[model samples]
Target: MVYKMLVLNIDGTLLQDNGRINKMTREAIEFAQSKDIKVILSTSKNFPAAKRVAKTLKVDNHIVSHQGGYIAKELNKPVYVNKIDEKITSEITTFLESFSCQIKLVHEQFSLGNKVKLPENILAKVVFQRTNRFSYSEQYVDNLSEKLQEGPVSPPKIEAAFDNNANLSDAKKAIEEMYDEVTCIEVGDNKLDIVAAGVSKLNGVKYLCEQHGIKRGEVVAIGAGIDDLPLVQWAGLGVAMGNAPAIVRSAANWNTRTNNDNGVAYMVKEHFRKQYKLEFLKKINVLK
Candidate 1:
């Protein structure tokens, strides 16, 4: 089957372990774009952060961020969004605060939250190291629940980070049990993103496909985390990064080399080199 759309996950799936895109990966994406495949970035990050990556790749397609609760062509304006109920958001924030975790309210443009001062917290430390991880500005608020209660808005999602995976897992279980209006998804080891029930990267991918008139069977998804399960399973062809955990790899159709080893490039060359012709080389006005 011919694939028309390629869904990319930024962190571990596309970028190498040191947090940069490799030359081979960059060239492969350009090659795919030359073939007219719709490339969409699906991430747990907010739209702005995703935009930076898109800019690097020169990709202008709609971005799927906030774990798929938010979608937009630009940072300030969202084309689609699914936020948790206002009342529930307040309740959820209140509950999350009790866990001594840093909570960030994820909106389309700016995230409102307090700076995590928990140095002993592993997630907070990583978050500090990667302040640009989220696509929006993080505005710290003392009383997030009160702020949510006072506002006419409920954020698309709330991401809470902890020191350990066990704490996050427990928090996820508790949050799920307490509020049926939202879904708690563990995007990484110690970070949990809470969004409206049923929001996921698969939902984001489905929306993009519908907009582009593509079908599920014509989609190619790549990911390397717990949050990637749905899209990996739904897409016609799912590729897991070699750096991905065994469970995520098991869920996919196949595995590519680790991102550091030019996994994306390998996948593209192995699968598409024969199926699709490269005409990009002919378009350049070369002088002999």
Candidate 2:
């Protein structure tokens, strides 16, 4: 089947382990654009971070960010958004303060996080990963729930990072049990993103597709994290990076090379090449 859209995850699928896009990957994405396939970036990051990557790729389409809580072509105009209610946000932040994790409330433009001391290494890997080179400023306060009390905030997403897996699991379970208005999703190891109930990367993409007149069977999705599993399984061509975990690879229709190995470049080129060859053969009446 012909694919009309390409959904790419930012961290592991597009950027290499070194936090940069490979040259061949950029070229492949350009090639896909030349073929008229709209490339949409879907990430757990806020818009600015995603925009930095989009600007690099010269992608002028809508972006799916905040773990699909926000979708917008530009910062001021949002096609869709599902923000956590201010009251619920306050309650959740208060509840989360009891856990041994760093709490952050993410809006479309900025992030407000609680000041929690963490190891330099873990901070770099978890919090800083999405915040690096971000155009928006991040403010850290002594308390997040108290900050919310100053003013009502309907943040699109809330994040919690834990140093221990046990804490992460416990926090996720507790949040789910306590709050019916939000869904806690495990994005990576010891990291959870809280969004409105029923919000997911797949549903985010689906919402965009509906607005653009696209179909579920006409999309190709690539991802490496557990948060990406729903879209990977739902897309017509679900691709798992070689660097992806075994479970993600097992769910995908195809598995490409590792992020460091130019997985995205390889996958995009191969799929389109086969499409071109099939079209040529059909034109020549070799097989119909």
- Note the Cα lDDT for every prediction shown: 0.80, 0.88
Residue clash pairs of candidate 2:
none
Best by lDDT: 2
Model 2's TM-score against the true structure:
0.92
Over 83-151, each residue of candidate 1 has an lDDT whose tens digit, in order, gives 888788777778877776778887766777755556554743454223474444667777777777667
Error of 1 at 183 (Å): 0.9
Worst 10 residues of 2 by lDDT: 273-282
| C-alpha root-mean-square deviation, each candidate | 5.1, 3.1
Model 1: residues with Cα > 4 Å off, grouped in runs:
119-121, 124-135, 141-143, 146-153, 277-288
Q: Which stretches in model 2 have alpha-carbon errors above 4 Å?
A: 130-134, 276-288
Local lDDT at 145 for model 1: 73
Model 2 residue 164 CA deviation (Å) reads 1.2
